[model samples]
Target chain A: MSAAVPSMPGTRRFALLRHGRLLTGAILTGALVAVALLSLLWTPEVPTRLRILAKLKPPLSEGLLGTDQLGRDILSLLMVGTANSLSIAVAAVVLGAATGTLIGIVAAMRRGALDALLMRMMDAVFAFPPILSAMMLSALLGSGRLNATVAIGLFTVPVFARLARADTKRILRRDYILAARGAGKNAARIAVDHVLPNIAGAILVQVTIQLGLAILTESGLGFLGLSISPPAPSLGRMLADAQTYLTLAPWMALAPGITIALIVAGFNLLGDGLRDRLDVRRDVSA
Target chain B: MSPLLDIRGLSKRHPPRGFGRGAGVLALDDISLTVEAGSIHGLVGESGSGKSTLARIVMGFDRPDSGTVLLGGVDVQSASGEALTKVRRQMQMVFQDPGGSLDPRQRIWKTVAEPMGLLEPRLARLQRREKVDALLASVGLQPADGDRFPHEFSGGQRQRIAIARALSTNASLIIADEPTSALDLIVQAQVLNLLMDLQETRGLAILFISHDLAVVAALADTVSILHRGRIVETGRTGEVFARPQSAVTAALLEQDAVSLASTDQLKEKIHYPR
Candidate 1:
């Protein structure tokens, strides 16, 4: 866009927009979040208020994506659904990663019996499939977005904690870390200041990838009637509702299904591109 | 002042675990030395000759199995948190691998200011910055160079930054463990000159550890030649180089006596890989 910065031999920097997949993914993610936020402020139809007048109207004259069986504009429902779904996923991931990273750092720094115990506990948690774990928790807490968020968040914690612990353990052995210890820095300061910054890039890449998985998991719960309950405009629930009317109104299922696929694909692509960008081996010149 | 650093019976042996347990590798065997204040004492040896180990012991990083390292007569063997901090503040080390020694994520300024932050917490943030800038300038780097990361600098520049960091704290003793090994010959000379200048102006005692005889010859006032973890020879740098008593020392200077000493089995190649 302007003057080119001198790059190391063989390391070429790409513009953010040049990486089409990542750019597309980021744009889609942002749009989804914006729509979701807007849904909170206003929606064309009260997602639950059933009105027979506009029922099952097909695209164009009836407006975009037409109307569902409940006469809710499919476009409007999508806006609300994207917001509701992403918010829950984001909240769960934030909570999970924050708590998990703390546990991981503590385990890495303290080590010994406590570290072994915590690692084993994390392993036990990891053994459970994310969906199955979320299902059980949702069943226990009853079907709701909050329950889904909590279940997903708890599940996500062990994943990040294990990653953080492994990375932190390796970083602690580095010469600078030893220097910090020699300099009389306490374990906490060393862990927070030195250890955390080094491993944060890898952790962040993991977080982004996990975020995609989180969205899919939350939607799956909704599809299974274990999240956000009925009447809420969730893409998963929409797909479930459209199942009975597949032959009659295929677009009902198609729109939301496509949204889910795109969102997940975008996240995966973004994560992949970022991993490439942040790669220490990949020099910044060519 | 009773020698700035005194060592007595400093022996460290790595237990050859697995199959080699019975074959004890005496990394440092009864290595004792005294470093007078305001003197540049060089510990010269071949690789695996225990020069690095001695530096490590002096810094309190490794405890000798049965030895005493005294920093101004205070035994470092049992120094705890506060005492160790105090000892470290009084004595600092500059490592061989500047890239490895520094936190890559940290800026040059942060690395330089770290020791000061640990030792002199009472100094205000602005004062610390001023001191760090001064230290950087003193090491031939401009004040603005502190803003750059370690990866941004060349090998020689990084070594200089490491030296600046070591000098930032008011350390009486600086153990430079092959501080210029990664640099090119010219840069190495430049760094050596800087060290000499610093020693001359600051009156700082330096323990310059290196396997390079030529480099050591350039800087060390007194040289201690270690072999198999023992100080085989110790004297003025010039005297040791001119008339090496041991064949191991002679071979180290690339003299023809290397093969002659092999007959005794005690004059094994020092095995110092560059």
Candidate 2:
């Protein structure tokens, strides 16, 4: 057999071309992040303050992007709304992915009764939609962004658990894991050193997709009056508030609606791109 | 001296499916073998002949229904936690598929040095790298090649990396389960020669399990022929090869002759470097 050779120059170039969609997704996600970060320090007008005379003013009039039904600045609300939605989505995704992946790894490592129990628990969670759970949680815990985040995060646990469990099981079957076991590495070491790294790519892709779902769920809860209370700007609440003034102030609904769509689309594209790049089988074939 | 690995009256049966109405199939039946330190004990058997089952039981990966596995004088089945880890540190295994044996995502250095990290745990990163380089060199792989991933190397090179990993802990006994079965005939010989060199230098006891009798004939000192979970014959390599005892042995020898002849023809067609 021949000595080790470096990967082909063409292969590197092909990888870049293959992940072009990832670059586009990153750009989209980055722009939204920038808007959210920009909102933290400054906005043209106060999001919550009312100016009665400027109610339902057209875009570029009394305030940029005009005023809403409460005569609150649409531009400011949209900026702050972006921040709120992004933060909640990030928190939920982190919470769900971390806990769910741990559960999944445990299930995969200890098969039989534990595996069945964890999966059944996930199935039970799967029975109720995220929105339904969020509504129940909102009623029980009192309506706010924290409760909404917790509810949505809990909903994503089962998804992450199933994905992590399947990926871990596949990795456990590899001979390297057997070799590690033979090498005197215990279950925890095997999981951390071997199983986790191999399955991280799959989990990462799932995380991005779950972020999109979390954002969507958060907005749905807000629209239904089960999310963050009024006076604080929320994209979904803004959409709900603007529904009555469809003719007089269509921009009110248009701004938040378009923002939610863009954020979700960005995350979905990013997730798809990550799946393509992280697919080990594709790398093996290449 | 006591054997490096000793199995006595080892038997394992898989439970029958469908509410366990029927009797379970015996994977290994009353099997017993011993590998002396610094000697190679070849376990030869065809597929479904329990060679792998024997390897797994000896490695403590699976428990036997009835028998004891003593590795380096420690009972493998009875040991637990830190004791089991200590016992395992004295033994390592080379799997059948070299490609699947090493993690594709890990660099050669990390893969080679993994056992050392697990067993010793206190070795500094630099020291581990030095040991990894030395291990790679011992396996005839360039020290610089340790930076590359497993996929970047040829099958033989990967197998060498696997060997390097197995040798990391400086184990007294190595269970090589068909280690050379995946490579070309010429490469297979090179790997076998490498194993022999390691065995001689380190005085390693090797349990070489393989389906090919010809391959075992080259390296094994004491040979055990298995058929359908039972040992058909056990003797010195020369005696087993020279004599005709069991029908299973005769059939296996005849099969090896046919395959060896075909291999010789193939070796001639393609000019392989010695």
Candidate 3:
């Protein structure tokens, strides 16, 4: 039987690439990832520099996007700051997905005491809102970017663990899984060979969605004065700093606020696109 | 002649505790059957008839509540890890729904070569590919088909690929669970014919499970009818078709007999048939 894939005005590739939301989101996310990776190598100015001379100079000759309240060029500060925020978000997502995927697999494979323990632990972790937990953690450890990153990363562990466990539970029940077990494969091999491959698409979709959520959460922490100390030029911190000079130059608060909104919206779009692409339900119509 | 596979009093019962609690459902009752070497025996039953359960028990995939499955007269129920592995090598299965049976991400070559990996270690990678190609060709599939993923092929082609995968292991017996049910009628006939041809050429004992009586009639030498977890009747394919004793068997033989609203006529036919 032939499938019925809906045809649009333009080709599928053209529609996907030319779409402003998808393209812009992809480009922005790609740029952010690249900048984050490259930050290990170089920065235009020492990120810690605090000079009053260059402070608050509007976007002009030497200072692109103007200097922040702390005299660092807003553009350079943003580049490194974007990298730092993204680094934490990416790490948290990866760590959370990996750990959660493992726990989910283990729970699915051996569903008795271990399953109960892991599930209860996940439930307990899920009991608290991630932001609240992060706030509590930052308050205890004092504020720092690393603390926020680690807190956000830790908070995400249960989210993934729950998704992975739920997805894996359903996947393990499929006929092919039964077929693999029939072939005399042990639990470990079946998990690795059969369960993991099938669940990967679902895992990928979840990771993308979680990536967006992670970014939003990290920015939220920075906005709450619980992350990146002071003068780090974080998007949230920049917005906080711009509040004092809101009437003088509304661009200060608006720029960083809009940047955060755009980045978050981009990640959200990318996640949605990925979900549509990776989902098995889409192929049923195809 | 001694039977190649003998199952005695195989009974599997679902515990009456879940959603359908308090209503005891017998998935498989005291059912027994013998499959001769180099023969194609078909087990026919409707949905929820426990034919699949029987296949699973035979293949060591499920543990029966009470029964003994003897493969080549060796008890498979008590078979340990390595013993189960050995049993698996002796008999492989080609599952229903070929698309679901094969891993979507794995290429056909790797899928075919996998069964051989655990059994035949000395078979080099290239040799395995060559053998896989030959196996595919035997099942009316092209060697190039092995490079593509499962989703790349049609339902019929995917079943042929699955048959090729089963053949790669060189097992003595094949438990084909509704191997052709998912295909179109024309494709189903082709796959059935292929199984018959393979059975004749290789002397492989096949335990074919299907819901279609007509399909079983075409290929199975012996036929067993299972109803609600019990083997109601079994005989030579022609004999069972000619003179089915049990009401379940008669309902199976006469088309539309099952869908008849009244059980009175069915009971009469079983108790006293013309």
Candidate 4:
């Protein structure tokens, strides 16, 4: 797979430029982030300002992407929605990856009883349907952005924990770990110093993949009216708003629907690209 | 004075394959050996002869069923906490594959300085860097080489880094488990020379384990021939190779000769030694 990556730094750069998935993904993701940032400062109209007369206006009739059922600018709502989605996804992923990776490594290092206990608990959580857990969390936390975040974040923990554990165990079997012990460094020190750095590639890839999933899961919750309570715009909320007027004003669904698709697709491609670039080099420990 | 490394009656048995302690393979059987303060000792065996098991036990990573491994006169098995940590500093190990032993993600200097950071906690960062540079120099690597990762270096260079790491704690003994078997003969010769150099300059003792009898014959001062978990023969390196007493010894020497004769045949086919 290193064949996909050139040996020379100069050639690597040239090859990276030619990587279509990475390039397109970067552009799409970059535009989404940029629009999210811009939404903080300005948009054509206040996303939540109601103007019932303009409701269900077709694209470019009143505002750039026209108005939704609530008569808020579709473009503005979608922009703010992008920002909200990104923040929620970021918070959830960080929470999940940190807690999960810690537990995973601890389980990996301890093994036997502790490993079984931690992993079985994680398995119980992991086996539960993610959407159900989100709904349950929304119920418990009382339906807001933090509730959505907590639900998505808690759901990601088992995913990251399982990845970190499996990868840590694999790395523990490596000769460098044995050499680390021979260096008079104990297991804890080796786990931090040696195992962490080696598993970084896998973690990074997992982080990117989870990020995309977080956005989707967050949007899904929003779609179910379990996220960021209405009047606060979201892509899923916008979709939900577009539902009643679908036949008469199909354009209402198109803008937020397309934007969400592009963002998710961009993140998936970026994750794939990173995996290709950061491929493990075939573990030359032969 | 006690030998730098003295292992006595070391035996290890692996638990049986299936459930129930049916029976275990005798991985090591009453193995005993010693290396003087400034000498090289070789442990030679075929793959399943428990060479690695002995190395593992000697390094205190694994327990022997019943034995004592004394490094710098402290019994490793009995040593605890500070004592065990201190004794660990006195002996270091080099594994068979340089690629496998060196952390690919770690810079070479950090790899070399690892033992020192653990054993010498008070060492200042600046002092550590200087000492690491000197260690790299001693191993015939450029000081700048420490900035690079292990994957950037060739196999020979990685072994040198491993040796430098072994030397970092000012270790009296290094248990090298096939340290050069992964390298080509030319690079192997260079690495062997480096080991010999360390032994002479620092009075470092090495417990060099390898299946290459020729390498042992060249490097070891005292040699032990391990066969099926037992040390079948022991003597001065020259005397052992010159006059083999045990059947295993004779057979090994014969095997060595056959390998050499095959090399000659290879050369003849090539038309020139070069």
Q: What TM-score does the predicted chain A of each candidate obtain versus native chain A? A: 0.88, 0.92, 0.83, 0.92
Best by TM-score: 4
What is each predicted model's overall lDDT from 0 to 1? Answer: 0.80, 0.87, 0.77, 0.86
Instruction: Return the lDDT, model 1, position B110.
Output: 83
Query: Best candidate, DockQ-wise?
Result: 4
Which candidate number has the best lDDT? 2
lDDT of each residue in A1-286, candidate 1, tens digit only: 3336455332434553447656777887777777788889987766676667988878764657887787778888888888888988889998999989988999998999999999888888878876788788866887798888988888888989998999898777666775675566788888877888888887888788888888898888888877786777788898888888888888889889998887788788878877776767411110
**Candidate number with the higher TM-score (3 or 4):** 4
Off by over 4 Å in 4: A1-18, A280-283, B18-21, B260-274
- Report how large a share of the reference interface contacts model 3 reproduces: 0.30
lDDT score at residue A116, model 3, on the 0-100 scale: 96
lDDT tens readout by residue for model 2, A1-286: 2235456667778878668778877889999999999999999987899988879988988677989988999999999998998999999999999999999999999999999999999999989998999888877999998998899899989998999999899888888998988877789989998889888999999999888888888899889988888888899899999999989899999999999998999998898898997885622311
TM-score of each: 0.89, 0.92, 0.88, 0.93
Q: Which candidate model has the greater lDDT, 3 or 4?
A: 4
Q: Check candidate 4 and list the clashing pairs.
A: none
- lDDT, residue B89, candidate 2: 80
| Order of the predicted models by DockQ, top scorer first | 4, 2, 3, 1
The residue-by-residue lDDT of candidate 2 on B1-274, one tens digit each, is: 8888888999999889888898888989999889999999999999998889888888888888999998878899999877887887888999888888888788889889888855778989999999999999999999999999878988788889999999998999999999988888878878887888899889998999999776777678999999999998998987997795888898899988977455555445433333
Quote model 4's TM-score for chain B.
0.93
Candidate 3: which stretches are off by over 4 Å? A1-21, A34-47, A280-286, B17-20, B121-123, B256-274
Query: How do the residues A1-286 of candidate 3 rate in per-residue lDDT, one tens digit apiece?
Result: 2235455535766666646555676777786677656766777767667777777777664455766666766666666667767777888888888988898889878999999999899888878877888888877888887788777777778877777788778777666676666556678988888778878888887787788888788878888887777766577777777888777656667666766676677787777666666674411100
Looking at model 2, the pairs that clash are none
